[model samples]
Target: MAPPNLPFRLIRPAPDPVLAEAVLRLLETPEPASEALAELAMRDAPFTLALLSMRPLQPGEATTLKRALTERIDEAGDALLRAWLMHTGSQQLQADAVGQLNMRAGQVAETAMHLAIELRYPRPDEAYLAGLWHHVGALSLLASTRDFPVLRDQPATALERRQAERQRFGIDQIQLAAWLAESCGLPPTLRDALALAGAHEEHVAGAHPLARILRAAIHIAGPDATLDEAARLTGLDTERLSNLKTDVDYLSTEGLKSLGIGAPGAAEHERKPSGYPMLPSGWRAVALGGLLAGAFEGIDGKRLSLRLGNAFRLLFGKTPPLMLTVTEGQVQPLPMDTAQVAPHLITELGLQVDDDTSVVALALRTQASTSHFPGGDGPGRSTRDWHLARWLGTAGILCVPWQIEDTPGVAVVGLDEHLDLPTEEQQLMARLVSGAARALAAERTRRRAMDQLGETLMASQREHIRRVTHEIKSPLTVIKSYLGVIGQRHPEDPTLATELNQVSQEIDRVGRLLGQLAHPESATEEPRSTSVSGVVQELQHVYGEPLFGQRNRELEIRIPGGLPPVAIPASTLKQVLLNLVRNAAEALPEGHRLTISSPGVLITDGRHSLELELADNGPGIPEPRLHHLFEAAESSKGGEHQGLGLSIVKDLLGQFGSYIFCRTHPERGTRFNLFIPLAKPA
Candidate 1:
């Protein structure tokens, strides 16, 4: 099947005598000294070349293949043979150690493929590669440094282990694994899989089966792990898990034998039939006591609600339809859903309870199982119970109260009628809800501090910009004044006059830019009252001919007669229109025309506002950049434009309490709706 023109060699050459002797000496020993072999393997190139020779050799070019195998072997025979023997022995030892730890992990690729095929998942090849290379960084670290094995004794999570390795060495296992994978010419998919060692923390709720299985395989093989914990984490019941465990044990022993290492006989004694751990006699006391002692961990500020939702899922096996926080006689639903109940519903419930009876209102406040049956005539029955039963259509309600530093809050868990939860489960749910409240409270405090810091930084930055632009503008203004005087005095000298006028115009542009940058807040203030019709007439008289003449495009202004004055000054209106007109003209093609038309609809809330639409015939804004068109520093225009025109226009429009809405598509060209408030009748 080989192409005739292909020059790469496929055959591996035989070892030279000196190299063969070195391999013989290593094989002859009962156990080759790992330290000595490791020292030799440290010289990377010769060892790698020897391993390469075991595969089919490719000389690559015809001229290189022309040389005899003997000649190539003879040139580096002694050094290559020694390195090759050392490499082979060291590899065998490493495979044995890793196999002893977890046979499934040692032969991870083949085992992963076997599991994938059995499960009927797609891409067995990708799964195999993901499993095989996931722990390659650890193996590489062992080969390169003798001290790496000591790290195994440190009890740490996968993330913690990598951090410790990074602290001791210059690089971590994941980084090291990536480097080896790349050097061996493995695909990027393999490299990426190896890099995802601790990615399970991020996708806990809806992880892919491939990711879940890989995690299960590693955890089951890990030292100090029990079958119960691994099964729970992997979503595998005892019956199905027993078979997987048996397979892992058998495959691991076979893998060690294939690598020429004696099987670890002690492994048989450690095996146990798959089952949940026996509940410790005092499990409830221990678990609840630990919770009471504040043994839980905190989470990130931004993901408080999401993490709380996941916790709820863990407790109930399904997320509740609604979770509302009751604070200071008010009910606030999580932002995830806002349509749970009407505002009056919360107000009605809040009125029925006082501060002394708040805890009793939420039924599951303690670990005790207490329920209120609809017609029970129970000892502690109250009027509030009847109201709750009648309005909510529930015989009973469960609530858990959590306090953060003495600030009391209650979490109401909405339930379906069919589900009846036990008291033990209710206690666990209480612990989870309490942890969420603490985390949310902590996040809110941190966010408040961050907001204050951000405000201070913004104020400082604005002041700096104002000071710097003022310094620059002072000299530029003086220079423009002198240039204007020169132009007026030397009107007869056409060339000199023309140059002076051009200089003055450039200075004016710079001044406008500085003013825009130094006083952005000024554009967002209240607008002066002015005539909308008068502003439109001025734009037509001043810019209509000049704007259209240069681009050879039509400029049409269609405003109805007798329009009322709007709440925008003439100058502010002119600037906003100028930016819009220029933008339209630049975007339009030679044959395209820009039109400003008013439909004359008065939008009234407390006061009346008018709507004007600017339509243009041009290629529409690109989809990717359309959402960010009004944001400063984002641009589609390619030349000298710095993406400030539209951003400035947006800020100026805000000053008049008006806004622009943009609509565009490839076929429809573009349209902008400008909404402006009309002045009260005088």
Candidate 2:
């Protein structure tokens, strides 16, 4: 008989005690071997399902569930697997019943493998999985319902057993299994095979090939008197069928041996309770409160919903509560974007606030805690309550109303029907929800403030750029006009005219760069490559006199002919060379020299690049200063210097897929090596 108000929690059963112990031992190692864990996982049905449910299936994954699960086990790594094992291991199972069920599942799985091999089915592994999990619904029922073991062990036909389950629990094991398979997002073919495994022989004739194999294997390995029917379904003769049965029996015995389950005497001795003892209620509440406080301690605005869900998980153990947001009298789920809550739930649980039938709606209306059960009589109880019980795989639900400072909402948690919470625990849940709402509201306020600050900063930056652009353009216009005057006056001198034209072109390039700064979105033109030889000659002509000649420092250019063009515009390359040359000249003494050279091509990661070296014979930079040489700081040269030269040089080179490296010693002067990518050929 069904226990009164059975909890009907849809929990995956724990793994076999022997297997759990073995897995825990492996997890205790510094690095657990994935292959070893996978081998054990394949032998246990609940453990395999738990591993698969941890991750969604990838596109173009392996066709069979067994292969897919093997991949998932490797991907999950040891930490996640260990945590899940510990969580499930805390819930103990009745040893005799679990052992019997596990052994039957193993036998059925082995038999399915043999049948698929004989029939030459394409996916024999998937057939094995279908057989192994065929009785998962019964296992789940056994885990949640205290009196389920008697029904499971009773002597009855498969159909009669299903009828009994439906009568007692309002739903049969087959329905439960199908629902769980759907929830896990199992492949359609495998889901159909699992759902159809318990159907009658006639009902499964036209089913999937894996379904037929699973059905035949169940009949062969079970205690039902259907050996003749199994033979007719699989087209196997009497002798082969007998041999198959004998081999499966031998294999089942070997499987038990591998699991360390000896004969009855040793097996009974090994069947100790695997779960830990529960703490006292007061201590448990304190521990839970501490955990919840930690969950909300440093809530990040970006990850507010994730932290909230975690806090709820701490409050309500394995089954976390579902959260809904209320907005202007319209209620919907928190916008977690299908990652936290399944999509189907979002569709089904949307309710109007004035709908008198929903407990969730009533909680919002009265702004208090409310609850509903399957057979309860109240104004708030309706068909929707029954539907929610089935969908959540629970017998009842509790709705706790919360508000984000005047915006009211509700938190709905699935409850074990048999669980009776003390007043203190209920009050603790209310306080936890209140704290979560406050955290969320504070996060919202923080985000709004951050958004406003960002807008203000952007406006200030734009204004600064506009002022800087206007101030720099006036000087550039004056320089260009002055150069034009010099060019016209020196029309007879070709050398002077060329120098004036180069200066004019540089002034125009600066103007264009300033325009780009003001409206960066419009700067979409492709970058141009600069000829290294040409840029070197232009630098010598433009800044050779003022920077080095005026400072009594010698400048040497040692570039080879026929070097490839680098991936930077000529104007940008000139600016970079000017910055380095000016810094070197300023740091060098009266007679110190700077040597600029192109040291051939470099191959890095299969790409060709040009290496440019600027070496100086000035005093070497101190070690402390060299470490942060490129960072902007107070200028060691003081007067009119902002120490932005090297920093700007670094930023400009990075924009063109180039890098800068420095090396120096106390005796030897400093060297800056620039790696500039060679431009692609047109």
Candidate 3:
């Protein structure tokens, strides 16, 4: 079955200089540099008005023409179609508006290129290239004039046009734009802005390239605004008013004057070469210009976003001045370009800021920072900018730095608000920042611990003194009471007196334990004589108890023949030896032989001394528990032993500028080696 041939109506001969010349000039530099593409699109934003007044195309013809245009180019038809639809209002029409969109896009692109060349916004070729598609919908709208009566005549007032559009078709041009945007798979930013273009009530949105270029291009072209109320409602200030009044008339009357061939007035704009890099031209403008007073917001480093669809929109369609609102705490990752930004309703989403430090900062840190962490696949980070430029899917991210409660560091958080995407570097930075916050929290915790420890120490000392006093007094009281009772009641019984004697013995034992506990040095004062050999012998006799030994263990104490013990305090040495032996016994396994080995343990303070070592074959202590194994009260915390054992050993040993510790092993056994002074004829 052959398709029916469609009717062909000759497009009216356009305004001699105004129509044909503009299109011809647009065709001059069709291929511009990439950076200039955005500026070109912006300059040609009002492409719909131009095509409407210049070349009127029917929906069918426009569709065919659009197919021809894109097919002529070596790009994917689907990609071109999608990109165009996203930026245009063409989808609102029953048939295709491709032809009108294509033609107007080409013209606008060319004109914007020329404007870019004049303005000096980097590469004019690229700007003009993008300018071509600045108004796909506008051209589409103009092309469909034969089918839709709503667009029959250009209204005198903006409100009248809006009302007429709503009455006739239940939607304004913006809705058409949104329809096209959705059909083309445009970025959310573009789709949203296009949908709200004519929705005055919803104008609190950010200024995206879709809106900025569309409206700005119209203003650049012959502006058809006639209503004062419309101006007030749209918030068109005096500067915009004057620019529209002058630029519009100039473009309309002069037919693209000098084509910006050599105009110094247009030289201020920056240009860019056509290549994949950090940002598009509009973003460059934002970075340099700071904000769009026309759009009314300061969109800086925080509100920047790059959308590939928007790039196409700016390159091949008309757009409007975008409105943007940005706050610091709100941040998101742009799916199209994989850029990071804060919460924003933007008109011109172009400001691109390059932060290199942010890259390394997130890379080195990947720890948790918050108590409640939302689960995700992994951290977000990217070393290469292009890896993040996948336009396959839509994703959103929000990152905010927060100090974790009771934690030491600040944390950055990434969110997929709609779960559209899970960006990389954007997430990583958030996590890294969070880790730092946790570190800060940890430091704070340590400080608080130290303060509490000091307070505890003070209170503990008073309690210990009180307990010691009571212990000392209680023994004396019992002895005195026993004596009194024996003299009064046991006067006629010898057996009663013997019972009293046993009571006295118990009281003496308590008194001895208390004395040892209270004054470590007061038990027995040993003469200050450095007798290393005698010290070893005394230690062996004291620790020779069999009850403390393991079932299969043999406790052996040996002093090699070459050893010399010249000077030492007998009591302190005894205490140190006793502590080591006790610890060794505790650590030894049942039925295992324990040997105290003193290898060549060196001791020197610019002088010679003795070396003693006690090595046993038993289970070795774990490495993690080694550092604090001899910190007095902390050694036996896991066991039912008073922490004072190692504490007394260390304290007595410190006074002699010497120390004693044993290296314990697992497979072979434990060894306690000590270095005692061996002076020669001192």
Q: Estimate each model's TM-score.
A: 0.40, 0.55, 0.27
The number of clashing residue pairs in each candidate reads 4, 0, 126
Q: Per-residue lDDT of 1-682 in model 3, one digit per residue for the tens? A: 1111112211111111122223333334555232232222233433332222212223333223333232222221122222222222211232223322333444444444434444444444334423443444444444444534345356557667756656654555555545544443344544454454454533522454334333333334322443343233335564555554455344532433333221212232321111112344345333322211111122222211212212212322211101111223212222212233222321132222232323212321222221111224333343221112111111212323333553222222222133222232223233333333343334446668989999999678756965876767686877768676766775888755655565464455456556666655567654555555566654554345542442456667666655655456765676677676777677777766666556654657655656666676767777776666677545443657876776677777777766666576568766655555555564
The lowest-lDDT stretch of 10 consecutive residues in candidate 2 is 309-318
Residue pairs with clashing backbones, model 2: none
Ranked candidates, highest lDDT first: 2, 1, 3
Per-residue lDDT for 521 in model 3?
56
> 384-468 in candidate 2: lDDT tens per residue?
6666655666667888777776678777777756566446556566656666667666776788999999999998998899899
Quote the positional error of residue 441 for candidate 3 in Å. Answer: 31
Q: Model 1, residue 558: what's the lDDT?
A: 90
| Angstrom error at residue 239, model 3 | 40
Candidate 3's error at 112, in angstroms? 36
Model 2 stretches with alpha carbons more than 4 Å out: 1-9, 31-39, 51-95, 223-227, 238-259, 262-482, 490-506, 515-682
lDDT of candidate 1 over 296-392, digit per residue (tens)? 2454543445444433432242333234454554544433322234545555655323433433344323423334444556424545444444444
- Tell me the deviation in Å of residue 73 in model 3: 57
